[model samples]
Target: MDDKNSQTQTQINLVVAEPVIDIPTLTHRGPVKQRSPPPILARFHAGYFRISLSLCGQAFLWKTLGKPANDSFVIRRLLRLLPSTAFLLLWSIALFILMTLSLLYLLRCFFHFRMVKGEFLHHVGVNYLFAPWISWLLLLESAPFVSPKSVPYLVLWWAIVIPVVALDVKIYGQWFIKGKRFLSMVANPTSQLSVIGNLVGAKAAAEMGWKESALCMFSIGMAHYLVLFVTLYQRFSGRERIPATLRPVFFLFFATPSMASLAWESISGNFDTPSKMFFFLSLFMFMSLVIFFFF
Candidate 1:
């Protein structure tokens, strides 16, 4: 019995020592490399189309209004001359810069969030869409010879504003309603200081009225930066956990128009009747969609 057991152990050892070889290596011809999917040139193409569409839209509006082009014609012409390749290059550069800034901002927000407790900064990074839009609006409004009717333009502006405010109320509920954090913060000494300063600047500009476009300009600038910071913070902190149903609203407010405005602002030198009208119109459309759908 002992010899039989020894023989079985020896057989097992022999089998184990048979020198196994990897089948893949034995059968291999050359390197087995993983194939990656094709790069998304489609999105790039889409971006170019969108940019072209915006330019065409601007041109159409200007032609419709019979407005004469000023020195801004140079910038507009340059943009028009941008070939598809150049457009792609410009977009790539801009996207890279934006992405880098977004990452940095997100890191800062994360650091801040860790340092603080339940004091979550609401939608910080996610709000960056406002910057380019504000910039575009400023450029449009500052055009050399373009003066759009203020009342009609303001109506368009409220279209976006009212809906956005309403959406904020709906999504945030009591926070916006009771004016808890938002109102409190707005009323805070520090916040109020800034607000008052802005209002004063705006009022002074209103008084001077011509070159004193300072207040609205300042407001636009401040809003742009604020949106950028809020967007970055929200992105990093993952606070904008908006459900799928609410995603369209979120995109409307923060995504589509934001990108469109950014592109328009980046290339356009002068914002005139066309740009302002578009800005207000876009805002109105977004807000209207939100109000109609959500509210």
Candidate 2:
């Protein structure tokens, strides 16, 4: 009886196994065909991209703020081990892997244009689309091998920034042409991501000695940031509509100002009066939100 039941279960399992699709075979067999990725790849979305953003940001921070093992007395005592160069190299490699995986998944998503379009139209999903470009910009800035003034670096900047500007036009244009009702309807804390994308690009431009271009990008970002900021603060869009996953982006209230201050400093070449103001505002907001979230 047990052997019979076992044989039956094995047969059922074999019958229920996933299909092996051959696109060429299907196309040759008939005019109709569909291309689908493995189930694991199909489940990927913008939410899975958050980790790369965090990794790129940390890599950039380490490049800007970290010192060699020999140079840092306090850091040496704390970490008690590997050189900072090892850390940076590890992060750079990890970033490359993550970016490659993301690109492949994105290519798969693009193959299914309808799915990509649907995501583009989704209010929350649309905002997260800016993430990949932002990660690329951060990775560029943190690359120790590439000098900002190099021709290759210059070319790479244009490649990355152009998409950011294009997205700005697409998203911000909708807000402008569609007007306040549309803005109110779509506005959410993660909407601030659009603002950060501009600020990050502006900072990268300033690093490349493109002052006027930096200012232009910064102005557009700040202008819309103000509108989105106010709309979100006032709850004109209604708080309940925001997804639970995105509520953490409430932290952007402080982070946007922090990014703003950093971008202004890059553009102006000094942390002067306005830069100081932005810095202080971000600090206060960070502390306040820290308390709010904890309490």
Candidate 3:
């Protein structure tokens, strides 16, 4: 009986020792493998690439709108005038070239399986492209020899064109992507209002009212961020349906005010005069109809 008990204890000890040896052998067979995370530099490059693509799209719109000014003859006629015109022409050319390069880079990145960050880039590109137009119009107004009266018309025309092009792009992204509806893309109250706020703020700044402009821009930026969060929520929750009444409200409260402000600023020279009033009114009505029916 004593010998049997001793044998049983020995067997139990061996069983425990076997598992300990087996565990060490298994662990030593190979080093634990770990997945490396994507590098920060790669993320930065992806962001830049996306922004460049959006800018390229915006630049394409501008290029299609009008031919580049033929200033070579004007340059020959006046050497002094040549310097400024040459500078403007060269700057514009550089912008076009950079836009193209960025677009090609974006395509390469996409095909190579690099991350493509599109949303912020799209917004930034649109704003950057529009900046030149705004600057040119402002320069024309502020030049000692230039007339301020001409500013309004140019501003009006540009305001209409930029938004229309953006809207078209938004529509294309929606319909073709097929993951989301068209109105869902643009009908975010926060985003729409934020854009309006930015425009108003910029306009107010030009008039030497910085405080109001700052406040407006800040409010708009906040609203835009909120809208982005809301969009994510809707996407996750699968609640894509916006009320029927809200559709018209978006047209009225958001689209109309934007168009009206642009029109008003564009026609600021003759606000009190009756002659251009009808023209401006017609312009507003036309844009309103387009936004309501189409967008």
Candidate 4:
């Protein structure tokens, strides 16, 4: 029995020492390399929400900061030279991109539920979702100029705003009601922008003559902004752990007040005392930001 076992082991060792050649059943081609899908077809992640930066620029330029420049003689003359249809076509392209991204984002969230849920638990990730609603409102603001008296704009506004408001309530409930670490979470500037998104919606609602709804949204947004402001200030004053990559979001401190002023002025139909106060507050915040960063 021992001799038989030794013989079997020696045979196995001989087999192992011999290199077996893998004969190809068919002709071999080069290695299969995976190519990434095009942007349109690619699976979007939560990070795609940063496209809202474009929406912010659009809102700031056409809606608030550069409204005067947009109406200037040079631009007006240039616009006059182009066909009126060009404006609508351009806006249509932008709207299409926004809708496509939003649909893709939803699909990603659906397919990757656990991953997306984890992202939502993070303060920045939850705030990033607000980008879609912000872009929707920004696009809606251009509807009047693109096609005056268009019913589609009103329809789209209701479709997006109602759901966004519902989402805002749900998200804030989770963050404020359920979250025990809400104060520590406020070190992230992106979280405050979620509150600003309500103001964006309020501006659009006011434009559509939904005064009561607009007032409600604006009030809720301001109330939350105040709380978030204090919480973030606390984080800034302490030895909080903030990632260097996200430090630029601190500019949101100024942007929130600036946008609040714009929304207030829009809803009130006048640049009254409160609007002026908000604007000055934004100005002070801007100065503070500059001083903090520069020095």
The C-alpha RMSD of each candidate to the native structure, in angstroms, is: 18.6, 7.5, 17.8, 8.8
Write one digit per residue (lDDT tens) for candidate 3, span 1-295: 9998887874334434333112322256675444333344244332233233334334332332222344554434444434455445544654555555455545545543333334323332222333333333333323333332356644643463355346435533553475544334533432343343344334434343244443444344334434543553365434444446444423423332432343334335223443244346546656766776889
Q: What is the C-alpha local distance difference test score of each model?
A: 0.37, 0.80, 0.40, 0.70
Over 4 Å off, model 2: 1-35, 67-82, 179-181, 237-240
- List residue ranges in candidate 3 displaced over 4 A: 1-117, 120-167, 172-179, 193-237, 240-259, 268-295
Q: Candidate 1, which segments miss by more than 4 Å at Cα?
A: 1-75, 105-112, 115-119, 122-175, 182-295
Candidate 2 accuracy as lDDT: 0.80
Q: Against the hidden reference, what TM-scores do the models get?
A: 0.25, 0.81, 0.26, 0.72
Q: Which parts of model 4 have CA positions greater than 4 angstroms off? A: 1-43, 63-93, 144-150, 184-187, 236-241
Q: Give, for candidate 4, the lowest lDDT window spanning 10 residues.
A: 18-27
Which should have the higher lDDT, number 1 or number 2? Answer: 2
Q: Indicate which candidate wins on TM-score.
A: 2
Q: Candidate 1 on 76-194: residue-level lDDT in tens?
A: 66665556465445434444444444444344444444422222233322232233222223323333334444554444343423433343333234334654334323221112112
Q: Return the clash pairs for model 2, or none.
A: none
Put down candidate 4 lDDT per residue, 1-295, tens digits, no spaces: 9998887874334334532233224336745444333444234665565565575445344434324343466655565566647656656666777877877877666556666777767656667777777777777776536432367767877887786777677667776666544456544788776777888888877877788988999999998888878877774444345578778878889888887887888899888999999999999999999999998
**Which tens-of-lDDT digit does each residue in 5-124 have in candidate 2?**
887874334456565454433455676646566655556677666777888887776665553433665654554455767866767675776677678657757665667777788888
